[model samples]
Structures are given as structure tokens and as C-alpha cells.
Target chain A: MTKFTTRLPLIGIGVFAVLLLVVAPAVLSEHWISNLGKYCCLAIAAVGIGLAWGRGGMLVMGQGVFFGLGAYAMAMHLTLETAGPGALPGFMILYDPLAPLPAFWEPFRSEVFTLVAIVLLPVIVSAILGYALFKRRVKGAYFAILTQALAVALAVLISSTIRETGGDTGLSNFKYFFGYVLNDEANKLMVYLIAAALLVVCLLAVWQFNRSRFGELLVATRDAEERVRFLGYDPANIKLFAFVVAAVMASIGGAMFVPIVGIITPQEIGASASILMIAGVALGGRASLFGPALGAMAIGWGQSSLGSSWPEGWIYILGLIFIFVILFLPMGLSSLFDRAKGLIRRSSDEPGPATPELREVVK
Target chain B: MSVPDASLVVSDLHVQFGAFVAVHDVSFDAHPGEVRFLIGPNGAGKTTCIDAITGLSKGTGTARFGDKELLGSPAQKIVRLGVGRTFQTASVFAQLSVLQNLDIAAGLRRSPVSLLRARRGVDASVERALEETGLGTVRDLPAGMLSHGQKQWLEIGMLLVQDAKVLLLDEPVAGMSQDERTATGELLGRVAANRVVVVVEHDMDFMRSFATRVTVLHQGRVLSEGSVAEIQADPRVQEVYLGTAGALSGALAPGAEEVD
Candidate 1:
């Protein structure tokens, strides 16, 4: 059983890699390609959420803070590049009129600075928050509430900072990314590829972390903090590391999201957005390798398709899905697929603990 | 074998909750490597004394870990200083695997941050701790699924990982089957080989089997301290046990006649 579990991950990864890298590009249409790219970025964020919430048992509701940091950083760079020397980005000029761009925004014009900020901002914020909260021994509902509050506050702050942050409208309408025109089909595909590649990398990183000693400790910390403490570990530190890693992943997703979606709005970095990320993670299977990424992407696709025809009803659909997933599928969608496979394997072998429904199907 | 000093000295220890005094001017020492049984009828500060020693509760008492002052130190610090403990209720991380529980407990002695990213060597220690507490088979199973007795053993396994010089166990066998009680008694006897083990217990059978010395507390005061027979034979203990002198003598009269 252990051998099968070990081999199954490798097989799954290989199959997924082939499908994503080879088949996806060959079969998907330009529009679908762009959409897939957007989902990929979301998947990255979901991966992080999975680590923090699923593995570490921290309900981090304020991932948007890091997401916003990455998005705004990338958005700032794209805006500055389009504006040229000495001229402010369109939103800054419209909102503030006479004000020069914030000094902090100056560095983002450089691609390297923008890239670094996308990763570093989330890591730094998460580290600080994780350190403080974990050190104080805050866990369970309190940690969840605190993270949610942070997300809420960040969203409000971004929305209110009309001059600097582009307010509720947010920074959008990018012409070029690096040198490629973002409007071009090829460029869009490239962005999608980048998002896909990053998502894969993030998954691999998390998988490796999970296999590592730290991963075991994080689970331990979640389950038996005092025991871990007695063993001589500060559970706070273990939890903090996982939390910060999750935050950084969310930030990277948000950064990539701006380019692929061609928009960065205050709405995407708000409480609702954070909840949406969590919903996807929960729906997918919080602890599973592909659950968060696939779950987030699936939700992203759902919102894009269903949201257009029924704007008000889309949120209700998501809510309903979340409720159903939690109620019927505690292990998330992954377990359902595993159960199906189990039934198939058992049919070829002998009878096992098959449910009445499964037995009927088998017969 | 000559025993080391088992003295647990607490000088001017004070604990307050806003304006409530939980422990006041409490001073006592259990000799090293001794099964010091702290027996109190109820609310006699038995658990409080253990908590103060393990630094779980805030107390203004100088709890000495050998020669070092344990006052103002965090619970983890106290554990590191060779003072291991268990809670009144079984406190195990229910969601984690049993092996993972021991791993975390063993890993607790190291910097979890560095250990989190690395995944070797810690397993051996965890396995050893598990072996010590006889939780080897269910190591892969989730701790939440463990029986209550198993959970208690797992908690003890966590303590073993700390390798503390002193173990402060609060009601170690509060809820257990007859077999579990016997197994636990045997386990504690094995554990007492190297450390100062202080147990707060209500089960006289469990305590009498292993306790080298017993300290009885009544209404936040030391009632008596001696061997099991010596303390059990005391008139005050008899009064406390029977609830009245007349009742105690009446109960003993039948036993006295049988012995005669």
C-alpha cells in the first residue's frame, strides 16, 4: 500500500505534466488558452492556501494581502513601462493630478524589482504575521479571524488609497509585457505558459516540503502543538513557516494574475477574493497535491463562464458548491476519484468493503 | 544504588489571576528519581503544584530544576531544562498520525524550523520514543483514532522525547481499563529508572504499587509525608479517609478483629 501510494504520486505528476505542457497547448483555443492561463495563476495561490490551511491547519483568510502586493507590484511595472519617462501612470494622474508617483513605485518600473517584490512582499508580510501570531500561541478560530480581518483591512485600504493604489477601479489596460504586446495571441499564450509553469513549480516545491522532515513537523504542530513543544519545538515557528510560504505563493499567483487576466481590481484583493481562494482549496481537497490548484482553476473557469450570463447568481453557485463539498465530500473531490478507482481495482480482484451503491454498479 | 538529591525546592512562589491567589507561599521538594506521590482529596493544589513546576500556570514560586530557577520560564523552556509534564486531560494532537505525534514530541527538542525542511534522523528518535511507550504498531494510524489508554501512552511518549530530568505527570492514568492500568503502572516503573517523576494521582492502587514516598496535602497544606504504609497508618489520614474519627474507628474495628 505504501509502495503504491509513493508510485501513484509520481505517475500522477508525470501524467499531469504531459497533459499540461504538451496536450494543453496543442488542443486549447486562444480564448480557452487565455482562460486556462488565468486559472493557472489562481492554482498557484490555491497551492499556497493548501499548505497553510490543509497541512498546517491555519485558516489564512488574508492571503489577498500578499496577492495584492504581487499584483500591484506587477501592475505598477506594466503601467510605468507603458507611460515612459517622467509621466505618471494613467490612474495616478487621473486620481492625484499633481502628485508624483510614490517613491516606492519607482523601483517597480524595473522588471527585476517588480519580480522580486512579487515574491518578497508576501514572504515578508507572512513572516511577520506568522511570527507574531504563532509566537503568541494563537490557533484555531482566532487565527482565522485575525487573517480575515487583515484581508478586509487591506482591501479597504487599497480601495481608499485612490491616488496611490488606483482605488476600486485598480490598475488595468496594459499594452506590453516585457517587450511582447499583451494583446497579441502569442503573448497571451506565453503568459498562460508562464502561469502554468509557475503552478507546476509551486506544486513540486510543496510536494518536496511535504516529504521533508519540516512537513511532518508542520502536521505534528497542527495536531499536537504541546507535544511538539515538549519535544522541544516551538509550534509557533513551524506553523509560521508554512503560513509564510502559503502567503508567498498567493502573492506570486496575484502577480501573474494581473498579466493573464489583463486586470487588477480592488475586488480581486478583498475579503471575497480571499474567501474564494479558500473555497477552491476546500473544494479540491486541502491536503492533496493538485486539489488546491485544480480546485481554484475549476472555480475560475466556473466564474468566467457562469458569471457572464448570471452575474448575481454566480456567487450563489460558488457558495452552494462549497457547502456541498464540505457536507458530502469531507476529503474533497480527489477522494471521489480515488473511490471510483478503488471500485474498478476491486472488481478485478475479490469483494472488499463495497457500499451498496458501489456493489450495484459492480454487478 | 545511591540516589541523587530528589529535593524539589520552591521558595516564595506566588501565582495570581488578576486578584485571585491560586498558589500562595507553597514550598515543597520531591527527592530526585523518587516516585513522589502528591495526593490530595480534592482542590488541594495538587495539580497547581505540578503546573507551577512545569511552568504551565503563572506562579510566583522559585521552582528549581536541580539548581536553576524555573520561575518566569515558558513551558517549553521548562521542558528543555529537563522538566517534562502531562496535562490533567489527555492533550494529544488528535488529527496527526500516532508516529507523527511522537516525531513532533521528539522533534520539539530541536529547532523545528530547520527540522521542518530536513527529513532524516528524527524518525529514529521518534521510533525509539514510540517503542518506549509501546505505541509502535499504531504509529502510522491517526492519533484521534487511538483508544483513551493509547492516547495517554502517546502523551507519555511525547514526554519521553523531551528526555527531561524530571517528569511532572498529572493524573497519568485517570481513565483506563484494568489491563491499561497495569500496563501504565509497569511503564511508569520503567520510566522512573532515570528521572525524578512526580505523579498526582487519586488511584491508591496505582500509586501504592510504585510510589517510593507519598506526600498528602489537605486544604493547601502538607498533611503528611512518609512511606505508603507509614502515611496510610497515620490517624489524620484515617480521619480524612473515613470522613470522621468515629466512622474511621468503626471501619477499622472489623479489620482489627479479623487480624486479632
Candidate 2:
């Protein structure tokens, strides 16, 4: 098949995604719309996971670290915005009303700083970490373990600093987002729209990456890093680039998630949370263009419904789904789409009358 | 990109892995337009020497491509210096098509911004390489499905697409049918016509037919370096082949000869 024809499914997905995000909000109830917005945030993070884990073979189990970074950055700014310029945040008042506003939380008062920090913090951290890890050729399961450990460390650090980070209770109780009353239902819908739109943008960006030479090189490095090295390319740098991009994507997801979810906690940025993010990507199909995002949304939706209905049994059901997908559909749900397409094509292709040469060849 | 006539020159190269010394004081000069084959016994450290030159292994030596010092350079830098190599085992991107495998090697744009631009998927050089390596028929097929011989050719095609001046291959034709071997020998000859080709292989018939010069290595050192005919006639080369274990014994002499 030509490149254009091969891209038909991706284009179809892009259209479906646009319709779902732009049109569905009008028909769905306010609560379901917000739920979808939350799913969009998760989907954004899962897209990055798919790129790093599925395409680049870098199992980034610490995405929650970047997500948490963005989340807290935005949360701090929102908190500061709610309070007057010199006044302390409400959470700090609960811990120590006498103590002055922390020096570290001073810069987040500026809206631009928080926005920049949301993208820059993850980029800087992931760059340094990726450089060190890839330079030493730390990959496969070792890389995954290191990233998971980082998530655990971040969670522990956040949990220990009770007064500074709102302790285990986490950051919440936001009254405003960018000077607009978040309490207003219209403004809430606007936040959901922004998150949904950003998810689509992330999907487009990933689509570009999937078709680029860099994407091809990334996959090549994943498969046979030594061969890519022989091809006048540094496998480490290639992997590092993908890793950093994934981090930035995760950060953006986390930033948007804070507004939609109205909470940021150590529990959401721990090793288990990171594993949950990976589970969604793995269930969808890591290598497929649309699979990761769709899979993440599906999983997030399942959690919202299933966890609410059977909070005790939901984890078991998700585990079963993960096991089933892994055991039977190693390529994930996307492979089924491909198989179905192949079957249709086969059935549609009518056989011509058999020639003597063809008969002899078959014999 | 000076297009140095002497593309690769290794002198006093040594590779030691912990307590075990893999390669010791191995040296050679590779010139443009000549196919030099490094033939040796099973444990002769030929791969170590190649790895040392390509910067895959840490070694103490002066490996110069023109005026550029290559000993301490990274593998990517070494390639950018116009030296390309193929693994002992044919390693192609199994998930990608033959055409894509070549395009990725040909496209050489390694940068963060390069991720935004869509790859053309085929270039003139990629087309030429595909035609030259006889993989044109299977260009669209995934490389994983290719026969062993075809995969080897595809890898060579990958190197060609890189526009490499110095091509180092480890056992390019290790596993091939007689017909495939002959075809590969011809392909290597054509590839070496305009570039410096360094091959580490065990096929005596292939070396005798294809190599312009042969470097015999034994016990991590250079045993002999001369024309294929001269090396074949040397008694020391014969003794090493005959005396080494059964694995090395099977390497050169197709039928075993009495050692006495």
C-alpha cells in the first residue's frame, strides 16, 4: 500500500477525536463532560507513554514525577492567585498561620512563571535524568526500575513535607483559575474544553513524530541500538529526545489535570499512579497512533464508573483486563483493527480465473 | 568530509576486558578502493580489534581517519568521521520495511526539531542502494521476513545509504547458501570498488575469491598481513588452523588434515 492509503486509519481517528471532543460536550450532561475532560488529561499522559515505551522502548514508569511537577506548579499559582499578593495560601494558614509565605512559593505568584514552569520543569528534569541514564546505556528493565524509584522518591519527599506541601491531604480548594470564577459552571466547561483541545493538539504532535525521520530513528534505536549507532546516529540522544518529549507531554497533562480534577496529591504522583498510567497505554496498544490515547480514555472512564460501583472489585477487573490484553493481544487493541481491515480486504479481492502457470506454481 | 585516501589506520590497538586481554597490539592501514579481510581462528580477537577501531570497545591506541583521532571518540562520532560498520549478526529494523530501513540510515538528520518534519520515506540514494543490494523486489516487505542472505545485503545497503567511506563488516556472509555466497562475494566486490571495505569473515573460499589482501590474527595479535595467496601459502597460518580446537579447525580447512 502507498503511504497515503496506509494513513487512512490515522486520519479517520483524527476526525473521530475532533468530533468527540468538540461536538460531544453539547449533548453530554455537565458531569459526564467533566469526566471526559479528566479522561482527556489521562489520555494526554498515555500518549507520551506510548511514544516512550511502545515506540522508543523506554519504559518511563516515573511520568507521575513530571505530571506532579506540572500539577503542583499550576496548583501553587492557582492557590497564590486566590490569596491576595502578600497574603499566604489557605493550606499554609492551616499548617502555620504565623509563618510568612515560603520563599520558594514566591515566583509562582506570576501567571507566566507558573505556565513556563509547567513545561520547563519537566523538560529540564527529564533532560538531565535521560542524559545521565542513556549516556551510561542504562536501558531495558534497569531503566524502568530507576524511573519507578524516582516516582517513589518524589512521592515520599512530597508526603514528608506536610506543612510545605499540604501533607497527605494534598493541594485543593481552588476558588479561581486565571481570574475567572471556577465555581461558575460555564467556566468549568471552559476548563474542560481547554483540556480536551490540548489533548487533540498533543495527538497531532505525536502524529507528526510518528511519521518523521526522528520517529523512524527512535524505533530503530529501540530495536537495534548498536545498528543505529553504526548509522552515524547516537542512540542515547535519540532516546533522550523521545524521553524529554514524553516528559513535557506528561507535564502538560498534569497541569491541565489540576484545574479539572481540583486536586494534586502524593497518592496521585506515586509509583502506583505511574503504573496505572502505564497500564492504560499497555491496554490500548503502545505502538499504534491512536491506541494509547483511546486506551487511556477507556481505562479512565472504566475507573470512574467501575471504581464508583465496585470500589473493592475495580482493581481486580482492571488487572484481569490487563492480563487478558497481554496474553491474547500482545499488540493491544489496535492489532484487532488492523486484522479486521486485512480480513475485509482479503474478502473484497476477487480471484481471477486460474492460469496454467499459476496452477503449476500452486502444485 | 575530506574524502581521505587512507580512511582508517589503526596502530598498537589493545582491548582488555577486566583481567582477560581480548586484543593486543593489533595494527593495520585501510586504503580507499581495497577490500581487506581479517581472517582468524575462533578466539583470535578479530571482533575486539574491529570494536576498538569503531569506538565500541575501550582501547589504548591511535586509530586515525585522516587527521581525526578516533580512539576515544564515541561510536556516533566515529561514523560521522566516515567509518561505518555492520554487526556480526545481521541487525536490521525488523518492524520496518526494507525501504524504510535504508531511508532511516540515509536520512541522517539527528535533532529534536527534525521530529516535526515528515520523512519523505524514499530518497534517490535509498533507491540506488535498494537497487544495488538486489532488495528492490522486497523493498516494501518487512525486513524480519527476509531470508538471511537478503538481510545481509539489506544491511550492506544500509551502510551504502550512509555514504560511508570506510565500511567494516563482521562476517557478512557467515550463513548463506553456495549461490547466495557467490552473489554476496560479487556484491562486496562491487561495494569495495569505490570505498575501503574491512571484512572479518571465516569463509576461506570467499576470502580467496573476493579479498585483495588478508590479515591473519591469532591470540589477540597480528599473525600475518599479506596478499591472500601469500597468507594461504604460509605454514604458520596452516599450523594455527590445524592445531587450534575443533571449532577453529572447522573454520578454515573444510576437511580436517593430519596435524603431524
Candidate 3:
């Protein structure tokens, strides 16, 4: 069972890289490329979900808090970049013409600071949150609900702070990204490439983690936390690490979401959005390495295509699929492949009467 | 008696849940190189005693392993202090292979950075644990798929790989057949050669065969402490065992002198 996570799907990864880097760019128009970029960011976040929820048994329902942090961080810097040096953003000027730039927004003017904030912001917040939650051993549904509430709270806070954060309208209309013109087709592709490349990097990192000793410990902790404690490990620390990593990954996805989608709204990093991310992960086989990413991308594609045709009805479709997966294929759609293989290889999946451990005990 | 630095000395331990005291001033000492047994009828507080010693439950009084106090420290800290325990139901990592379970247990001294890389080859300690537990043939099989007795051995093997100086196993042979029970006894004999092996059990036959020393507990306090032969001959143990468990088959040792 664990062999799926341990074995690196080399051919699959190579094909994915080609499609993301080469084939898609050559064949598709810019509109679809931009859509794929959004999906890429979502997929990046899903990989982390797989690690946290799938492997570590942490149902991190408030991942959008971290996503919001990264997206807003990147958006603030870009908004400031569009405002020119020493000038307040246009929204602040519109809301209060004489108001000074918020102190928190001032530091984002520096490119280095913006870059650091993308990763560090989520790390610090998640470190605190994870330390508190995991130390108390808050788990399962309670942990999930607590995290989801945080995302809602953050969204509400952002919604109310119209001047400082642009509130519900969010931060957009970015003319430049790190001195590069966002309007340029080549620059747009470059941003897309960056997001795509980062998704690949995240997948590789998680792959390494899945096969590593930490991965085994994470699984052990998930399956039987007390057993892990008896094995001389502080389960809190193990859980904290996975949760923080997942948060950071979500943050990175949000940061990338800004440059790709050209917007960072509270709606994108709220409770509903966070649930959507989880929906994708659960749709994919959460336990497998590529499941969450593939699942998220599939969901993204569905939203763009089927959603365009029937916006209200698409949600029903998603709900039905979710219910079906949860009921029959709890492992997600990826397990469908396993099921097919099981039908072909009937008897191989189960240990037969020949296992020496069974034979010796029987004798 | 003076307790050695390597011994697990649990003295006057008191554990309470609300107003009811589960373990009321129970005391016993287990040393390396012997298999210690804690035997009692149902609700005897034997499980509570080990739970407190392993820091799974809060308790008063001193349960010491070397210089470190076991009662106040956390579960992982007690484990780090070289004490390991197993649950009554065999709490091995069900989804992981036996080898993976042992690998995770043997990683006490591993650095966080090194854990990021995949394991290249099995550690000598893990290999030794596989050999010791007799799970070598099924090392790659998931622990959940193992036979009931094998899961118990795997749990013990996990502790062995951690190099735990003291092992507290709760009902290690509770669900085993006669053949499996003898095999487990032999395994415990080999494991106790250079460590403190403390077992909380109810099977009188396995206890008589494997226990180097026995402590009987009734209702939360220690009733008797002595060698297996001495405990068997004690009239007090006879009254507790025969009085409460005479109707229950195999709760008393075979061919013991009946109260006459």
C-alpha cells in the first residue's frame, strides 16, 4: 500500500513536465494557458494537502489562511509596484485621499521582502497554529472545523478592512510584476512557467518526503499516534512539521495565484475556496503521490469547462462526484486504477496460504 | 533493597480518576536480566500501573528509571528514557510493513535532516530486530495483515529496536493459541536476558512458565511479590485466584495445591 508513495512515477512525471512546459504552450491560446496557470497553483496547494491530510492524517480545513497570506503578500507588493515609489495604492487614495500608506504595506515595496514574506509568512503563522493545535492533540473533525473557522475569520477581516486591504474587492490591476510588464505575452508566459515550474518542484519535494524516513513516521503517527509516542517520538512535533509544510505550500500556491490570475480576493482564500481545494484532494487518491495534484487540476478543468456552460448545475455535479467517491471509492479516483488492476490480477493483492509467518504460526 | 540505576522502580504509585482511585499505592521494582510479571483478576489496576509508569496517565508517587522520574515526564520522554510499552490489543502501525515499524522505532538517535532522505539499506539494529522477533519472512508485509500473535511479537520487536532497557507489555499473549503462547514465552525469555521485561498478564500457564518473579495485584494495591514458586505457594494468592477466578478456566496454574 505504501509502495505507491515510495515509488517515483518517473514516466508520469516526465509526461506531465512535457505537457506543462512544452505541449500546452505550443498548442493552446493564451486564455487557456492562463487558466492552466490557475490550475497549476491549485495543484501545487493540493500536493501539500496530500502530504498533510493524506499522509499525516491532518484535516487542515483552514489552508486558505496560509494561501491568503501568500497571495495578499504578493498582491500587495505588485499593487505597491503599480503605485510607483513612495506612493500609496490607488484604493487607499480613493477611500481616503490624504491617508498615508499602511506600515505593513510599506515593507512589501522591497522585492526581497515580498519574496521572503511569501514563504515566511505562512511558516510563522502555521508554526504558531500547529504548535497550539497539535500540542493539545486536537484532531479529526475538531481540528478540521477549527481550521475552517480561521479561514472564514480571515476572510471576514479582509472584507471589513477596505482601505488597508481593498476588502472584498481585493488587490488586482497589477501593471508590473517584479519590474516585468504583465501585459506582455512573453512575460505572461514566463509567469505561467514559474507557477508551473514551482508546482513541479513542490511535487518533487513531496515525493522525496513520501519516501523518506519522516514520511514513514508521519504515516505511523497518523495510523496510531500513541504507538508513535511509544516509539520515542513526540507526535506533536511530527504533526507540527507536516502541518507547517502544508501551510507553506498553500501559501506558495496563493502567491503564485496572484501573478497568474491577476487578482487576490477574499473569496479565493475563504472557507469555500479552502473546501474546494480539499474537494480536489479527496477526488484524487489523497494517499498517492500525484493524486491530489491531478485531482485538483481535474476539478479546475471541470469548473472552467462544465461550469461555464451550467454555473449553478456544475456544483450539483461536483457534489454527486464527491458523494460517489466518498461512498464507494473512498481512496479517490486514483484507486480506480488499482481496482482495475485488482480485477486483472485477482489473487495477487492478497497474501496467500504460503506466507511463512502464517505457516509457522499454524504449525 | 537498593534499586540499580538500570532498574525500573515504581514505588507507592497512586493513580486516580475523579474520586475513584484506580491504582492506590501500588509498588514494585523490575530489574534488567529478569522477566517480571504483574498478575491479577479483572479491574486489578495492573494496566493503570503501567500506564502511569509510561506517563500515559498522571499519577503521584515515584516511578523512577535511573535518575529520571517517569510519573511527571511525557510519554515520549519516558520512551526516550529507554522505557517502551505495548498495548493489550497490539498497537503496531497497521498500514506499514513490519520492517518499517521497526525502522521508525529504531530512529531515536536520527537527526531531523537525515530523515528527509530515503532509507538506503536496513540498519543493523532493524535487521537484528527482524531476526529476533522471527518476522524476517514477512518483514515486507503490512503489520495489519500479520497473525494476532505475530502482531504482538512485532510490537515487542519495535521496542527491542529502540533498545528500550525496560519493556512493559500488557497482556502480550491474551489471544494466542497454546503453541503461540509457548513461542511468545520463549521470545520473552530471550528478550529478558539483558533487559527489564515487565509483563501485565492473566494467563497463569504462561506466567508460571516465563515469569522470573511475580507480583499479584488485587483492586489497586500489590498483594504479593516473590519468585514464581514462592507466589504459587502463597496462600493469599490462592484465596484471590481461587476465590474470584476458580470458575474461570485456566486462570490458576495447573496442578497447584488446592486449598485443603
Task: List the DockQ of the predictions in order.
Answer: 0.38, 0.53, 0.59
- Report the Cα lDDT for residue A67, model 2: 89
| lDDT of each residue in A105-191, candidate 3, tens digit only | 989999999999999999999999999999999999999999999999999999999989999999999999999999999999999
Candidate order by lDDT, decreasing, is 3, 2, 1
Docking class of 1: acceptable
Where is the poorest 10-residue window by lDDT in model 1 chain A? A354-363
lDDT of each: 0.78, 0.85, 0.89
Candidate 3: where are CA atoms >4 Å away? A1-8, A347-363, B1-3, B244-249, B252-260
Candidates in order, TM-scores: namely 0.89, 0.93, 0.94
RMSD of each: 5.7, 4.1, 3.9
Q: Write the per-residue lDDT of candidate 3 for residues B1-260, one digit (tens) a residue.
A: 22488888889999998898889899899887888999887777988898899988899999988887888999999899899999888888888888898999989889999988888889999999899988998888888889899999999998999999999998888878999999999999899887889998888888888998999998898888899888877778877776643422365442222111
TM-score ranking of the models: 3, 2, 1
Ranking by DockQ: 3, 2, 1
After superposition, the stretches of candidate 1 with alpha carbons farther than 4 Å from their true spots are A93-99, A338-363, B1-7, B18-20, B109-114, B117-124, B244-260
Candidate 1, residue A3: how far the Cα is off, in Å: 2.4
**lDDT per residue (tens digit) for residues B160-251 in model 2:** 99888788998888778889989998888888877888998877878888888889999899998899778877778877877533323244
Of the true interface contacts, what fraction does each candidate have? Answer: 0.64, 0.79, 0.84
Top-scoring candidate (TM-score) = 3
